[model samples]
Target: MAIVDEELPTTIFDFLPCFFQVIGIMVLVSWLNPWAFIPSGIATMCMLYIRYRFAHCSRDLKRLEGITRSPFYSYLTSTIHGLKVIRSCHAENICASEFFSHVDTNTRVEYLFLTTTRWAVIRFDWVTVFFVAIVTLLSIGLRVFGRQFSSADIALTLSYSLSLMGLLQWTIRQSVEIETKMTSVERILEYCSLGQETSVQRLPKYEPSINWPSHGRIVFDNVSISYFQDSPLVLRGISLNIEPG
Candidate 1:
């Protein structure tokens, strides 16, 4: 579960640079007094949307951990129980169909999620390219208009803007991913903190061993067992003895 949670952030981090580059190009266009900021801002919103979608996916994935596990375990137990009937009836094909159906449902859901995410990333990339072209054209126009901006200044702005955009985009993506992952982490911690069941066969060292004298007698002078501090005793002493034949 931790591994699954970690993967989302890692994936987002890996693709963050492209998003930043797009924003940087927009900033450059803005510097040249062009409307490049418009598309860039739109692209930023798109990126935010993508992050929201992924955050939702991460949460769904975590939820699936429980939902799928339950059905899968149920299927396993049912399969095992019906194995004899399956073999006797030669129902291999039927079993295979059932198994694959479950697998296909899971696969379809995952594929849909991936496809949507991929489309968002690709769209952002295109937006970035569009903004870069706008900035370039605007820069040329500014030169023609006698604004006299240096090539080095343009280059530096583009570089720094791209870097900053990229860093910020990645930071936002990572934050969403972390928030999603924390849900899974909390569940895991809750599970881990649960108290273990006591073993029936184990007894404390101070407990008396089962031994008998020649007369075969037993005693319970003051025995009691209580489940909670405030609860009445479930069992109480009523001494008895028995003799061997």
Candidate 2:
């Protein structure tokens, strides 16, 4: 969503200067103006602070949500596999309570994460508004006090001011989104670096006859089917032997 939604507009906003200054309508009122850069810097600093402050919180929230979700799914699978055993053991209430607790915890963490996101959005919006006002005010001051620019130039300045603010807002919003998205990215990287088991540990090293399975024999001493712990056995006490050379 960040790449598709946020990054797209952010890249488009990169064309703001070309859209304005290149057209000769806004000459001195380019994004390189001190008014634009100063406020942009301040807004960026604020966003950086916010990201740092919420950095640990965001990771913890994702972790908690993952923890809660896994157990809920585990419980569901176990329940489906062992409904009869759960009922027989009279653990229906306990199971239901555990499921609800997981759900409730996950819901709370999700809500908190959204709230933090909204708070960041609002802060960026305020910065955009303030930046716009500063640019407009400076342009007007230049005209009224020093008569340094003509009406046409003033109009151009105002337009560029608004455009610059939009560009600033877009860039900052994308930065915030990427910051949050990085948490998920970091977790994925961690998962990618996990240890993997080799099939040789489970498969026999011995090789069969050259024709392979020519005299293969099948045997089963005790094989059972149970999806999870504390679940009813779907199959048990099974034995079979088949030789088909």
Local distance difference test values of all predictions, in order: 0.63, 0.65
Q: Superpose all Cα atoms of candidate 1 onto the true structure and report the RMSD in Å to 1 decimal.
A: 8.2
Question: Could you estimate the TM-score for every candidate?
Answer: 0.52, 0.59
Winner by lDDT: 2
Q: Each candidate: RMSD to true structure?
A: 8.2, 8.2
What TM-score should be assigned to candidate 2?
Answer: 0.59
For model 2, how big is the CA root-mean-square deviation?
8.2
Distance (Å) between predicted and true CA of 172, model 1? 5.7
Q: Which one wins on TM-score?
A: 2
Cα distance off (Å), candidate 2, residue 183: 3.6
Model 2 backbone overlap count: 0
* Candidate 1 TM-score versus the reference: 0.52
